[model samples]
Target: MEQLNLLFEGFQHALTPMNLLWVLLGAILGTAVGVLPGLGSSMAVALLLPITFSLDPTAAFIMFAGVYYGGLFGDSTSGILLNTPGNSSAIASTFEGHRMARNGLAAKALATAAMGAFIGGLLATTVVVFFAPTLVKLATAFGPAEYFALAVFAFLAISSVVSESIVKGLMSLGVGLALAMVGVDGPSGTVRYTLDIPQLFDGMSIVVITVGLLALGEVLHIASRIHRDPAAERVKPNGRPRLRKHDIKKAWPAWLRGTAFGLPFGIIPAGGSEVPTFLAYGTEKRLAKRRGDIEFGQIGSIRGVAAPEAAANATAGTAMGALLALGLPTSATAAIMLAAFQQYGMQPGPLLFERSGDMVWALLASLFIGLVILLILNMQFAVLWAKLLMVPRHYLYAGITVFSVLGVYAISSSTLDLWVLLGIALIGFVMRRYDLPLAPVLIAVILGPLAETELRRALTVSEGDVTTLVSSPTTIILYGILLAALLFSGAKHLHRRARQRTGDSEGDKELIDA
Candidate 1:
């Protein structure tokens, strides 16, 4: 009941003219970013982090929340029309969505994607509103050991389980851990890795790392491959994205089911929405098959488009909750949001609600408004958004390159940052070239220091007792989950290898479905 009152107060702030305009602006910009290939919400937020330095934290967060939700729907547009999903989270959508477009249901696919995102985001945000505060209570019980355990769990889940190549993911994580340690040691007061450079004492700025990696790195990568990559061809959407009664009836159930699939994963740190999205898609396909009405691999099922889009947006909404309640980032975008909190001199955890309750509530409330704005922009005007592809790909990437340089330089007006930016951008290009996962790097960089600090703190408390790390029930349970995840991932890996050796091409489609 008290939460309801707080939410009502939140609506008061979200409904203000300036805040509403920011929400609208974020929605537009986010969808545009999502429609473009090789860009995602993480890059968008990182590029905008400098703007946060000047705006009120509440307003900045509210806009970021808008962009986060808006991008979920936007990525589906490319998948349905051009068959080039902007993010992995939208891969499942393309399985049926692009097929639907090819079958002359382009507008229908767009409508289904938008509607699914709306339902899933709505339910997920509501769940977070009521349930996340409960997590704050649980967070208060965490000691350094537990926090360290949780970070390790996150590291393993993202780097080892979620990525395609375990070696590549772990390598990316190792690089990030190394980057995180490149500065003066805090407690020891020993300068390390600075190379006598005064600017290196405070450590590499998170803003520079984020922008360089996500925005500028992507720009360079795209520029490098522009001549080699084939152009994307999209089915032109002819009609308004209006759903008939029959289509709605078929899709409504899937939206709810997908939301259910996605709600819990927001807190799991399982490397973004890809897992839940695939689960939702697989479940819908299996159920449709049982009914002898499978529409996949044929004309494309509306349920197929509906479920995965819903699950993706649902996961995104819940990820914000996890970010606020525990300072946990389940996806790259949430990882950047965690950094944004630090930029504002705020640490998100049990103390966050006590410290910034009003802002948190307002941010949550604005999500609903953002959802409405996104639905309107995406559903009726999806074809217009698709027109973004009309711009030459090279030109788009070139603009991004210029924008990233200016944004990074504006932060500190330092030549050293520009040098660092180019170096990191080159590293990012190599990481992408080798198909290494970027999320592990971001996760490691953000959590690596905390993990190190917590380990040392635990050691201090236990007088160098190594067993103290797993002494608590919380640590035990966390590590137990981590072990289970590793075993499961290993079993799957071996099974996949065995199947490949036997020339089982039947499983290839499932691999691509995710």
Candidate 2:
């Protein structure tokens, strides 16, 4: 009840005419960017970071929250209609969503995605409102060792579990950690990797790295395959999406299950929405009727789209919790938002709650409003958004690349930054080509310096006593969890490989017998 009253107060602050306008503007812009393949919320937020410098902090953050949730809503349109997932979280949605579109159920797919996201967003925001204060209090009690351990847990969980291969994931993390080392050492105040370049003194801008990898790298990757013939486009819906009674029955359970899957993972440090979505999808497949009128993939199981969409938006909301209280970013979009906060001379930690309480509450309030706005816009305009698929691939990617380069250059007016963009672009291109996950790299880049700084601080405070690193119960528990995750992941991979080999051997024996 107290939390509800505080949230109402936050609404009072967020519902001001100017703040509402910013929220609407952010939603519009976020939707536009999200509809464009390769330009996700991270890139959108990064581009808008500098522009927010002149605005009130509350208004700027409200706009950013709009962009974040708006992108999640908009990305599904592309995934369902164009078979191009605007955000990685929407990847699973593409499987059943595009299939549904091809079967002339495009409207249904879009509706479900939008509504599921709303439900997820609303629930997650509620979670944030009730839990954020308590979490902030607990986080404030954390020592440097606990914080360092938390960083390690984030790094390992995200890098190891999210990617297809652990080696590639670790390599991406290594690259990001290396990039994070470019600036002068904080404790020693000595240059580490500046190479005497003046631009290096300030370190590589988050805007540069984000735009380079996500936007430009994605553009270049698309360009490499532009010559291939496009797939037959899915038909767009001409009327409102109607859910049959049976469809509703099926979808409701999926919605509940998906929300169940999402809420826990959102609060935990698992890698964004990917794991939850996959888990939900797999669970739905297993729990589905053994003999059903509708096949799992055929006719588009509502669970397929609902689970991932819910997980995606839920993760986004909880990610905000992590960022605001713990100074951690669980996803790329969150990282960019963190950079935006820093750009505005605000550090989002315990002190932030004390100093910027109203702003924080207002941001949370805007999320609830944003979810409602998203639901209306998505349901009403899904067909129109589907029409975006008609855009020529070449033109879309070309414009993105141009904008990416322009956005980066505009930040600092440095030709050297352009060079760095190209270099990172090449690196990103290779990583994508090899099927490596980019999230780990971004996570490492953002968290590496902080991890290092905190570790050193902990050690200094303990006068080099190694036991001090785990003196606290929280630190010990966090490290234990990290260890368990590593072992579990390793065991799973080995078992999967063994199963594959066993099947291969059986096939060979059959061939020999024949």
Candidate 3:
């Protein structure tokens, strides 16, 4: 009853004209970013953060909430039409969504993605509203050792699960940790990787690194193969923007299942939507085989479009809740938001709800509003976003390159950051060429310092005893999960290799005999 009353109060404030306008602007800007390939919510939020310094905290967060939701809605648009995902989270959507587009069912695919995202996001937000205090209680119980363990779990899960080869994943993680070490050490004021450069003391800018890896890197990679790769066929949205009865029937269950896969990981330190989205895609494929009616893989399946889209959106919602209640950030976007909170002289945790009750409640209210607004916009304008493909490829990529350079320079007007951006862009291009996962790199950069500081704090508290790290039940359970993830991924990899070898040996025997 008390929570309900406070929620009502929050709605009163959130519905104000000024706050609503900010939300609308954010939604529009985020949608534009999502429609453009290589731009994501994380980069959008980071680039926009510096501009929001003068805005009220409530207004700033309200705008950001809308952007977050809108970006998810828009990501599926490009994924379906262009076969180009706006971010890693949308990769699963592109599998079947793009297939549907190629088959001239672009409208249906877009509608399924929009509806699935809406349902997942709305349900997850409901969970956050009712269960936030409960989550806060759980978060308050965590100690330094527990946080360190959670970070380790994230590092292992992302490294092992995201990439086809665990070795490549671990290598990507090493790169991130190496970059994270560039700045002045927190405990000792000594810079490790700066090479005595003044700009190195402040550390590599997150904006520079993200823009370099995602935006600039993509641009350069495409430029290298522009002539080799065939031109993409522009997929025009067709028919009414509504799913067929059969597709509707196939999608709801997948959406629910996907939400189930995504919600829990938001609370854990998992690397964000990519993990749950891929998991949802895999689960849907297996279930489709048993059902036999819904096809997957080579053919376009509405469930394929629905489930992963839902999972990704659901992860976004729960991720926000976890950030608010736990002071924990599981994804790059959440990490930037955490930095925003810190800039405002605020800390998110159990005390946040008590100390900044009005802001928290109002922010929650804005999420609900943002969901409704974005759903309407996506349902109506998905085709409009698809029209982005009308632009020439050369012009499109050129614009993206210019935008990346501008956003990085805007951060500090420093020429040195531009050089760093080019360097990281080269690294990103190489990694992409080698099929190395980029999410682990971003996760490592964000969590490395936190993990290091927590480990140090735990050791200090334990009087240098290593056993103290696992003394807590929470720490033990987290590590146990990490071990399970490693074994499961390892076994899966080995099974795949065994199948490949069997196929090769059999082929070799036949050729020799012939």
Cα distance off (Å), candidate 2, residue 495: 2.5
Q: How many pairs collide in each candidate, listed in order?
A: 0, 0, 0
Can you give the lDDT of residue 392 in candidate 2? 61
For lDDT, the strongest prediction is: 3
Ranking by TM-score: 3, 2, 1
Report the candidate with higher lDDT, 1 versus 3. 3
Among the numbered candidates, top TM-score falls to: 3
Q: Give the per-residue lDDT digits (tens) of candidate 1, residues 1-514.
A: 9889999999998899999988988888888776654455665677666766778988888888778876766677855765546566776787688678756678888989999999999999998889886644554577889878877876777677436567887999998898888888876788888889988888886656755776567667767876676553223444657899999999999999999878877776644777677667766765775587747657899999999899998888888888888889888889988998998999987689889999988999999999999898887796665444345656655665665566557657889988998888899889879888676676677677778888899999999999999999989998998798688777767887887866766567667887
Misplaced by over 4 Å in model 1 are 1-121, 128-133, 230-367, 378-382, 498-514
Instruction: Kindly provide the TM-score of model 3 when superposed on the true structure, using C-alpha atoms.
Output: 0.76
| Candidate 1 lDDT for residue 452 | 84
Could you tell me which 10 consecutive residues in candidate 2 have the lowest summed lDDT?
Answer: 229-238
RMSD of each: 8.3, 6.6, 5.1
- lDDT per residue for candidate 3 within 153-248, as digits (tens), equals 767776776577889989999998999889899887877889899988989876577668866787788788877876552334465676778778
Q: Per-residue lDDT for 134 in model 3? A: 71
Candidate-wise lDDT, in order: 0.77, 0.74, 0.79
Candidate 2 local lDDT, 135-238, one digit each (tens): 45543576778768867876887666655467887988898899989988889998878889877986887656755676566666766765562453224353
